[model samples]
Target: MYYSRKRQPDDLPQEVTAIWSCTNEECNGWMRDNFAFSAQPRCVQCNSLMEKGERKLSILENTSPNHSKKK
Candidate 1:
């Protein structure tokens, strides 16, 4: 008997928005704007100031109770 499995892609909404990328060329790190704390967020990996840019990424869901809608 033989078995095989195929990798599946993530299920998320795609959109173009601001992003934070590490200034260090050696480190490859980034984050979405909506999830950032300030206008300019620093790279958590290398503690370097991140650069602002635009990119297409999956929509991150907001499941926090603090962000829940009123009834």
Candidate 2:
């Protein structure tokens, strides 16, 4: 089986957004701040406590009508 090795254009708009990073060093769990519904979010992957941070991610509009503004 052969697969194309060409680098495809992934030019999506990027933004430095707020995020939650897991405090557990072994866990690599994180989430976009705007998408989080709670003042503090637990890692969905490891259920560990998370801290505030920033990351460069492809801009995404959180269109979930039920989402609440915590910050």
Candidate 3:
């Protein structure tokens, strides 16, 4: 007998966070908010402006050494 099922990774994350959505009419692009460095970000796919939005995605850790902090 042989197995036919694929095994899932053990490091799967369980959380949701904000993201940026592309405003392009014919493009489907989005990015994590934490990775953004500006108040308003442009879509990397079509260079269109992005809007704030929420999505249910796996948790991600931000490890940027030059991360800016707001008082």
Best candidate according to lDDT: 2
Q: How would you order the candidates by TM-score, starting with the best?
A: 2, 3, 1
Candidate 1, residues 1-71, lDDT tens digits: the string is 99767534465568887789999999999987667777788899998999999998776665665553323
Across 1-71, the per-residue lDDT of candidate 3 in tens digits comes to 99766645555666778899999989999988888888899998999999999998877777898766443
Winning candidate number (TM-score): 2
Cα TM-score per model = 0.66, 0.79, 0.76
- Pairs with steric clashes in candidate 2: none
Poorest 10 consecutive residues by lDDT, candidate 1:
62-71
Task: Estimate every model's Cα lDDT from 0 to 1.
Answer: 0.78, 0.87, 0.85
Count of clashing pairs, candidate 3? 0
Per-residue error for 21 in candidate 2, Å, reads 0.4
Q: Once superposed on the true structure, which residue ranges of model 1 sit more than 4 Å away at CA?
A: 1-11, 63-71
Per-residue error for 16 in candidate 3, Å, reads 2.0
RMSD of 3: 3.7
lDDT tens digits, residue span 11-61, model 2: 676889999999999999899998886888999989999999999888888
